[model samples]
Target: MLSDDELLRYSRQILLKQVDIEGQLKLKGSRVLIVGLGGLGSPVALYLAAAGVGELHLADFDSVDLTNLQRQVLHDSTSVGAQKVDSAIARLSALNPLARLVPHRTAMDVDSLDAAVAAVDLVLDCTDNFSVREAVNAACVAAKKPLVSGAAIRLEGQLSVFDSRVETSPCYHCLYGHGSEAELTCSEAGVLGPVVGMLGSLQALEALKLLAGFGEPLIGRLLLVDALSSRFRELRVKRDPGCAVCGNHNG
Candidate 1:
């Protein structure tokens, strides 16, 4: 049951036809795991907390750097050199003390990753490189948790949701196989602040939809965003029958 203050705080969200009191309650009961505290993780963490997610587990082994200020909205100048999770927790707690915030300041290994995924209702992949993304996907597949993945570099951004609990749904491994590729970083390629912010916001939206069971998630569909051209395109994707992570070929 929501306290009167919570009811008043989230009144706007509750008023939405797609998210009435019932949906709001569902959100209050959902636990979310957010991986990364960089550009994409910033907005994802902020919005999920503001929306009253019951608990949020933030994982980021990095620390705040001066370079992160431009796109990493969650950290401010004072946070320079501070642990990313510390900075995120301070900001998110200020936003909604009612929402629990757990910080994992260390890098996530396979054991820790699996443990985190198994405990959450949903996992948000705000990671940058393919390696972490692939590992996160495998963990979610084994745990059968829904994963909302987002990425941004330069003026481009993309969002996708992979729910392993659904038999026909695609996992990240289905989209990007276990292959090596040039890893791009915002520092080298240069990402517009708003570009990553846009995807991060949408990532939060998709997570909320999945948790509240209110709308169609991005599952099996990739939403491509070109901030420079102001264009949005979506490509339909499907599960790979031979996907090692979520296919029968696991053997």
Candidate 2:
């Protein structure tokens, strides 16, 4: 049951015909895991929390750096030496005290990652590391959970939703098989703040659609953003039958 305050707090979104009372309840009942509390994770966390997600499991092992303020809006000058997850908690808590915040301040290895994925209803992969992304995807595949993945570097950004629960949907592994060893990070290649912010915001929208059961998710499609030209393109994606991570699950 939504408290009177919850009803008032989320009235705007709840008013949407697609959402209404049922969808607001769904959002309040959903538990989400957000991996990475950096550039991409910032907006994802903010929107979801403000939207009234019941519980948010935040995972990040890095401490705040002064440089992160440019894109990581979840933190501030006072958080420079604090852990990212801690800073996120402070900001998100203030944004919506009705939302519960769970922090995973340490790096999650295979076993821990598996447990985390299993505990949540959905996951948002906001990490910038390919290896971490692959690991998170494998865990989601094994747990049969939905994953909303986003990435941004330089002036380009991409967003996708991979759900092993959907037969035709591709897992992250199916789309980026054994990613390049030379892949660059934002720190190395340099990314505009709004580029990551855009992808992260989209990632949040995708998660809400999935959690609230309201609209189409990017389950079998990849959205590409070209900030320089201010254009958007989407490519159809299919699950790889031989995908090492999710193949057996589908079979």
Candidate 3:
């Protein structure tokens, strides 16, 4: 049951045919884990909170630097030197006081990551590096939770959904082998501010669809954005039968 305030806050969302009162309530009852609080995390956090997700667990260890202000919209000049999760939560809480925001200021260890993933209904992988992304995906696959992963570098962006809860759905490890990939940082690669923002916003949209059971969530498909040319493309992705993380072979 929605409080009068909730009804009024989410009335526009509820009015959508695909997201009637029932869908809005589902969103209000769901919990999500956002595993980064940088450029991608900024919009993912804001939109999810605005959409009335019941609880949001934010995990990030970095402190805000002036450089982050370019794309990390959740923080302001005052947040410089503050922990990313703390800065993000402060802004998110103000955006929607009705939503519960949990901040994890430390980098998640293996057990901590697994526990967090198991505890949440869904996860958004907003981290930049492949190591953290791999860890997050492993935990999500182990817990059989849905994971929405997004990345933006330079003027390019990519988005994908890997739902282990579905039998045929590919886990993140299926798309990219467990082996490490060359790490790319926004600092080195130089990302356009809005590129990450666009990817993050798309992540939020996918999360809402997964939670509210409306529209097709991007499962087993990758959406690529070429911000340089303002073009978008889709690539079909498949589960690897021998994927170490989600495959039949088990040690």
Candidate 4:
């Protein structure tokens, strides 16, 4: 049942034909794990919280840095020395006291990553580092969980959903070969402030749709947004029959 505040807050979404009372309930009953509290993860957390996702698990070992002011909006200037998870919790709590937040201040190692993945209904790969992205992907694949991955740099961003339950959906490793191409980290190559927000917002939309079972997700397609040209493109992405993690491990 929605409280007066919830009804007022999400009235727009609640009134939607696709996201009616039942869909809202599904969103409220869902659990999501957002790995990384940086640029992309910021908006993803805010929108999901406002939309009333039941629970959220946030993991990040880094503290709030001044340099992140432009993009990591979740952490304000006042939270400079605070832990990323701490700032995120405070922001989300104030945004919606109804949300249950779990914070992890340490990085996820192989031993503990699976447990994190297992606890959530889905995992959002917002981490900028390719290595960590791969690790998160592996964990989701192993747990047979859906992974909504998004990335942005300069003026371009990419969004995709890798649902192991969907036989035709492509895994992250399938698009960017398992170990090919030089890894790109957002730290070294800076990301435009709004670019991350744009991508992250789309990620939140995709996640909500996935939870509510509403619209067609980016399962077998990659959507790329170019803020520079104000254009967007979608390319057909296919699952590799030989994908080591996703293909071999039948979810």
- Give the 10-residue window scoring lowest on summed lDDT in candidate 3: 242-251
Top candidate, metric lDDT: 2
RMSD in angstroms, candidate 3?
Answer: 1.5
Candidates arranged by lDDT, highest first: 2, 1, 3, 4
Instruction: Report the error of model 1 at residue 206, Å.
Output: 0.1
Candidates arranged by TM-score, highest first: 2, 1, 3, 4
Best-fitting candidate, scored by TM-score:
2
After superposition, the stretches of candidate 4 with alpha carbons farther than 4 Å from their true spots are 179-182
lDDT of 2: 0.95
lDDT of 2 by residue, 1-251 (tens): 99999999999999899999999999999999999999899999999999999999999999999989999999999999999999999999999999999999999999999999999999999999999999999999999999999999999999999998898988999999999868999899999999999999999999999999978999999999999999999999999999999989998
Residue-level lDDT tens digits of model 1 in 99-195: 9988888988999999999989999999887899999999999888999999999999989999987877999989878757687688888998999
Query: Residue-wise lDDT of candidate 3 within 1-251, one digit each (tens)?
Result: 99999989998989899999899889989999999999999999999999999999999999999999999999999999999988887898889999998878898899999999998899999988898899998899888899999999999999999998777788888888855676678988899999999999999999999999999999989999999899999999988878988886222
Candidate 2: stretches off by over 4 Å: none
Q: How many residue pairs clash per model?
A: 0, 0, 0, 0
| Model 1 local distance difference test score | 0.92
What TM-score do all the candidates reach, one by one? 0.97, 0.99, 0.97, 0.96
